[model samples]
Target: MELEVRNLSVSRGGVPVLEGLSFRLAPGRALILRGPNGIGKTTLLRTVAGLQPPLSGEVGLDREAMAYAAHADGIKATLTVAENLSFWAQVFGTGDITPAIDGFALDELRNRPAGGLSAGQKRRLGLARLLVTGRPVWVLDEPTVSLDVDAVAMFGAAVRRHLATGGMALIATHIDLGLDEAEVMDVGPFKAKPPKVEDFDEVFL
Candidate 1:
């Protein structure tokens, strides 16, 4: 499986943010997006995931082959840890979640409600959903947000396992998640330039 971005452009709230960005990710590889805040890392991910339309150009990939995990944990607070994982597994047409359970060290908390988990625990559960997706491509936004050092290590190992199985990942994060093999792309250079002083003033006309 592969992902191709050709001259892609993205905008937020009618303001162009990133432009002319292109990249390709082959199987068993990862691409880490690095940039300052509000540079459209998340926008680019959402665009590629097909959650939102790009301002221009194209992203070539089967939507079904990619699993998107936004910055939010996206867990139902009322559901138990096991229940949350099970729900996603069923949705993905898989009856087995043992690997995801063990991968994120959620065995002991399986019966615990998601509401009772700490911020870090909730983040872990959110990431575990990727395992249930069974998709070859993973798109994660700031996946390491609330995770501690040890949990970050676990996340890294899980990502490594996914890559070993011919899966690829596109991640946007500030801190290092310890994915040494993943190629890096700085979004700064891709940011769209601001309008000229006269052009900006003319917009009020």
Candidate 2:
């Protein structure tokens, strides 16, 4: 199934940020969102992921088909790396954590508590959760924040593998992931204009 966003308008803190944005991501494809920081990339991603409602337009997709990963690791501090993957696996009913453990190179850290891991290791463990999601579309925001060069390459490889299996990715990142085939959308053109005084006056009228 494809993911479609048509004439989507989104806001942050009740103020509009993007308007009239549209795109379609087919199976096995990737779309990278680009713009200046604070340009509402996160808001757009969240809206698409159904984490927040859009001010207008439509995000057409089954909520179950998309898996979202933000800057936060989303791991349980008290659980071991392996346990964390297993938990998400169970949540998604995928029931297998081996690939995720190996994909992110978390094998050695599997038995260690998540809270004890270094920043990069924690990030890896967090990302590994995506593999177990079994969802077709990945909605990621700054996925490489705490990763090193090698780890970034690992992530790039994982994404390629996912696409190879007909999975799609919607990512917002500044650095290149070596995904030459992926399309980039610069959201600068969609920046929302401030509402005029009369527009606000209509609210109370």
Candidate 3:
């Protein structure tokens, strides 16, 4: 599977987040998106996932090839970890999450409601959903957020395994994910934001 971003631009409330950012990924490879806070990392990831629109560019993916894990855990707070996995698996038509859950050592938390799980556990559950997706191209946003060092290491191992099996991932993270020979795309050079106090926040006040 292949994914290419062509001159992608993103703007919110007339504020430009990304400009002319572009890249390509081939099968069995991974790319890491790097930038400081509020530098459009989440915005770009959302654009790739089709969750949001690109302000002035396009995102193209090969036919039948895509998946995403958002910065915020996509797991439903009301559902148990297992239930969430089951729902996504049936919807996406792929492997069950029990194996993934076991890999992440999440089996014990499977019966717990997502809302009751800790932050790290929720992220793990989010990762588990990807195993259910079974898509060739994956876009992950801050995938290790809220995870401890060891859990982060575990997630990296999972990503390596996926790539070894010919799957590709686009990961946005402040910490290294330990992927094999991953290319680093520096988005920091694109930061274009003013401090909140620099905004006109008194329009109606």
What is each predicted model's overall lDDT from 0 to 1?
0.92, 0.93, 0.81
In model 2, pairs of residues that clash are none
Clashing pairs in 1: none
In candidate 2, position 81 carries an lDDT of 90
Give per-residue CA lDDT, model 2, range 22-83, as digits (tens). 99999999999999999999999999999999999999997788899998979889999989
Task: Provide the lDDT at 154 for model 1.
Answer: 99
Index of the highest-lDDT prediction: 2
What TM-score would every model get versus the actual structure? 0.95, 0.96, 0.85
lDDT, model 2: 0.93
lDDT of 3 at 132: 78
RMSD of each: 1.7, 1.6, 4.3
Which structure is stronger by TM-score: 2 or 3?
2
> Which run of 10 residues does model 3 get worst, by summed lDDT?
190-199
Clashing residue pairs in candidate 3 are none
Residue by residue across 1-205, what tens digits does model 3's lDDT show? 5788898888766678878888988777899999888788988887787777778878887435778888666678899888889998899987477777876889888789899998888888888787878888888888887899889888988888888899889988878776758888999876655436544766445
lDDT of 1 at 159: 96
By TM-score, rank the candidates, best first: 2, 1, 3
For candidate 1, lDDT tens digit of each residue in 45-164? Answer: 998898888999998897888899997877999999999999999999987899999999999999999999999999999999999989999999999998999999999999999999
